[model samples]
Target: MWRYEKRLQYPVNISQTNPKLAQFIISQYGGPDGESAASMRYLSQRYAMPYDKGKAILTDIGTEELAHWEIIAAIVHQLTRNLTPQEIEESGFGPYYIDHTTGIWPQAAGGIPFNACEFQSKGDPITDLFEDLAAEQKARTTYDNILRMVKDHDVCDPIRFLREREIVHFQRFGEALRDVQDHLDSRNFYAFNPAFDPGQKPCGCKKNQ
Candidate 1:
């Protein structure tokens, strides 16, 4: 049994729009390395995790990723600001403008649609956590790359925020890894993947060893 909270971890307000930058940032919004994929991957993978701690981390992180997905969408909206009808048509934003009218949609920079194939949800806890950790770093790197590509303060601010979040998430996953592995039997700690051995004690906290 799990409890879920529906809320964004942060707020996003993009006051201006630049369609050019919007196109670029949309990659992180809906691309394979986007927050949308990251969130979905972790949350979906939680169901297969064998331990409560892993499940808790996955749910929390997954929910947060949804918020991040929203934030990225907000950034895209901001970046696509003030497009005239002519500009929209010339810039090839007309198709998007027709449907969204400055609203956010999940699609890559090159207009590649989002798909579930971007991520995985293996039932194994250790494997899943490792994947999550890598995902966070990948997102962080993407944000950094975005920052490098753009000079807008509005875009950079949110991108930086997202980048910091990746660092924080990586730390949390590290702690979760420690919690899960430390619980294993001392003798078998290094014998195999730590998540598979339930016989391992919690935290390896033996007082009389």
Candidate 2:
């Protein structure tokens, strides 16, 4: 049985609106590199995980991603609300305004359409964990770019929060990788893979220095 926590991992508040920025930010909300895919990918893959530790990692990370989604949505809402038609036209948000009227969508910053092919769930623990590690790095980079582009404090606050969470998720996935290695028999761990070794040290999950 899974326990549910409704609280966000971090708080999000938007004090003002900027339609142009809102459109760009909403791209990540549902976009390829977005939080929605991150959470769904991990949570969905948990069904095929063979170990409890792996399942737990998926559950935790997935839950955190849900918080991330909320933060992005909050930012979008704050940035897009109450825009005059002239302001929308001046800001080049007219196209989006015409379609959704301040609605959130998952297109790219450049207005490219979002696609689900951006993420995957391979079911193999090693493969999936490796993908997750890479995904976190990608998301961190995206947040960094967003921060550099936006000047609003309200927007940057949640973006910074989301970026730091990526680093933490990367570290946790690294720990999960070690957990996977520890589950394997040493003598046979690298027997099949001749290109590299699985390393000598077992997982160090509890003792963080």
Candidate 3:
């Protein structure tokens, strides 16, 4: 269960409405490297994680990513607010308005809808951690790209915060990966997966005396 918080993690108060910019920013909502993908990636991967520390990391960061998703929704909502029909048409938000009427929907800047294929939840710990590490970096890059195009102070502020969190997530995933490697069965850590493979020493298990 999650506790409800009425306040945003970061405030987004845009004085100007810019649907064009919102179009670009929406990608991080449900786009490939978006918060939605990041949240699902870690949470889903947590089920198979071999270590509690890794699980905890995934839970903490995954929940945070959900909050990040809310922040993005807020940004898009504010950006697209108080638009005239003419403004919407001229800004090239016509296609979106017809579908959702200024509602929030997950999709990339390029117009591709959010898809599960965007992130992976591989059952293997090494594989999943590597995937998480890469996901965080990619998400960071997305925020970086957003920053480059953003000129408004209100938009830039929260974008920067999100970008910083991505770096922290990457560092956390790195720590989880290192922990996994350290606990691996040295004799066969490379030979087989202690998480799954049998007929071999499992990580964290003692040999029969």
Runs in model 3 with CA error above 4 Å?
Answer: 186-190, 198-209
- Model 1 residue runs over 4 Å out of place are 1-8, 89-101, 185-209
Which residue pairs clash within candidate 3? none
**Model 3 over residues 9-100: C-alpha lDDT tens digits?**
88888888999999999999989999999999999988887788998999999999999999999999999998999999999999889988
TM-score of 3: 0.91
Q: Candidate order by lDDT, highest to lowest?
A: 3, 2, 1
User: Per TM-score, what order, best first?
Assistant: 3, 2, 1
Per-residue CA lDDT of model 2 for 8-116, tens digit only, reads 6677677777888877777567776889889888897787676788889999899879878877887887787788989999999988778778877777766777677
Among all windows of 10 consecutive residues in model 2, the one with the lowest summed lDDT is: 191-200
Give residue 4's lDDT in candidate 2 (0 to 100): 56
Candidate 2: segments with Cα more than 4 A from true spot = 1-8, 185-209
TM-score of each: 0.79, 0.83, 0.91
